[model samples]
Target: MTSHQPPLWRRAVAELLGTGLLVSIVVGSGIAAQQLSPNDVGLQLLQNSTATVLGLTVLILMLGPVSGAHLNPVISLVDWALGRRSGTGLTLPDLGTYVVAQTVGAIGGSVLANAMFEVGTSISVKDRATTGHLLGEVVATAGLVLLIFALAATKRGVLAAPAVGAYIGAAYWFTSSTSFANPAVTVGRIFSDTFAGIAPVSVPAFVVAQLLGAAVGLGLLLILFPSAARNTGDIVLPHSAEKTSA
Candidate 1:
């Protein structure tokens, strides 16, 4: 850990707060979209995607310095996996804490969004179960991972905030499942029945697909950037004080 880096507890808090705000943005915008564009599915999607893109960019930029803003469990895990051999990135215990914080934060965010919309906490009933949807999730998650790590690998980490947001916005339109790429977000969406919600029954398959996609993404990262050219410090925050040789 870098001398300037916050202690583990503070970093964990940042992760929790960041992930919570991210999910709140997703669920809140989805609810607002449904209300503003009642009958137009396309318009609703556009609204949701726009909000998500802008919100995500801001969130990453704001929180990256604190916790690397790994709002997604998969990103944290992937960072650990790639950097473990070099003892540069997240430790094994950090991985567990980050994932737990992200998951809990996401669930809290969903509930908070629902409360804001005057919708009491409720389980999602929207059943999104199909091979095509599952495949889309896999593709979406894979692309997301590829984009983030690719930026890190190529030393373009500064562009991650905007690039990641833009890719997710595009994936929302292109993917059949609307790109629920983060496992924590997927679990969070189960708490709402609005446009962004996913039924409990469908959560398992989506998670499995996301994990598989992450594996594929890791493989691609290894293939495309096999050397230890990446700076581990740039994995999460572009201008962070930490510098880990790779």
Candidate 2:
């Protein structure tokens, strides 16, 4: 593939489309699990979460070559913090464009779920979203973002993409929120009226928690992988930050 400086329009569109696709697969799977095994919620969550990880991993692998497929605002922020973000740090234009694309994409994905499952907001908020649950969301999302940056954004992780997928799969099990790591995914879940709906009032807490968790995860990653964490990619894309500047 060629190194790209995408037309602004195309990149923005890609961000939206990618987010939409992620939600459709994720929320769609959650609905499927519920309907297929209504009585066994534990099993349902496990199956749905597994499908989600695979879906996201596959989506990233497929779309990443085209767009870098950051897929989450927190992931982008962590990359910027780590010095791997394009333009060397997060620029307002880049951040704004990405956030808008992700938000729009989330809505698009939710709409698709609405159509496919015949789901409507008519189903009231069963998941009022407690503070503890939101706490779980923060921890789960942060770990996911940190993993993405450490493994994919950093130079060492560029070569360990498959491991990134493995770690995510496990995170879904270990984390209390079943690892709804992507902010785009979190945003899209609001559209679902099933077990995943997060009340609008509680969204601020979730977002704050996600941001904080990502920070902690990054700190842990730096401590654990000191040498690799030091990598600062002179490269923008298609090359690890660790690549020699020859």
Candidate 3:
């Protein structure tokens, strides 16, 4: 190994590349659902949701070993705030790097989706979210980020693929934003004209809602597992950190 650690830039680049890949899968799958549907929107939604879970599952399993598959900025920020990461570190600058990478990656992913699907603005924003919908989104995303924190923060229980996959699959239908805690993913969907795509104007609200959700999730997790506070050794390092070190 080199004497010096891989600079923060490489780690940041990995995050950007990984987020871009995830958005491509998410947006592309949404487009596929629309193209295959005739009038059965329920079936279309099922297809869209299924595609999302499968894509995310594989991405997590694959990238989880590398980037921690964070893809979601909220997840990264919360982890850093929790003081879980160690020798390698998760600094504010690191948080900035991750978010920037993920955002730029999301933009690239959205552009790719547009180029592939030829969607200009088939599905655009409607209006400011209603109080109920906003609340629902907040609750949903909070649960999502909490789940990430719970899975990463603790070490006693194993986070097998089936358990995590099922949880994500279930979360999608339950949330107003369909449990999209990833700001990058949320922003990228604006480029698509599919049922799964969000309107550009509506994206900011979703981001705010998710940030709130993450806070809620973190609170609940801490409350439920007070004992876990002592142990955060494993959760800190990005899944890829080990690889880069090796």
Which scores greater on TM-score, model 2 or model 3? 3
User: What does the lDDT read for residue 1 in candidate 1?
Assistant: 35
lDDT of 3 by residue, 97-163 (tens): 8888888998787778767777774545544366666777688767766666566556622363444
Considering lDDT, which of the candidate structures 1 and 3 is the better prediction for this target?
1
TM-score of 2: 0.81
Error of 1 at 83 (Å): 1.3
Output candidate 1 Cα RMSD: 2.9
**Whole-model lDDT, model 1:** 0.87
**Model 3: colliding residue pairs:** 66-240, 142-213
Ranking by TM-score: 1, 3, 2
List ranges where model 2 is wrong by over 4 Å. 1-4, 84-90, 121-124, 153-161, 225-246
**What does candidate 2's lDDT look like per residue over 1-246, in tens digits?**
334345556656767887888888777887888889999988888777777667776766655544456667776666566665334544457667877898889878877877898887433265535776667776776566556555543554443345556666686677766666666667777767776556566566667777878887778767775643344232112322122233
lDDT preference between candidates 1 and 2, better one: 1
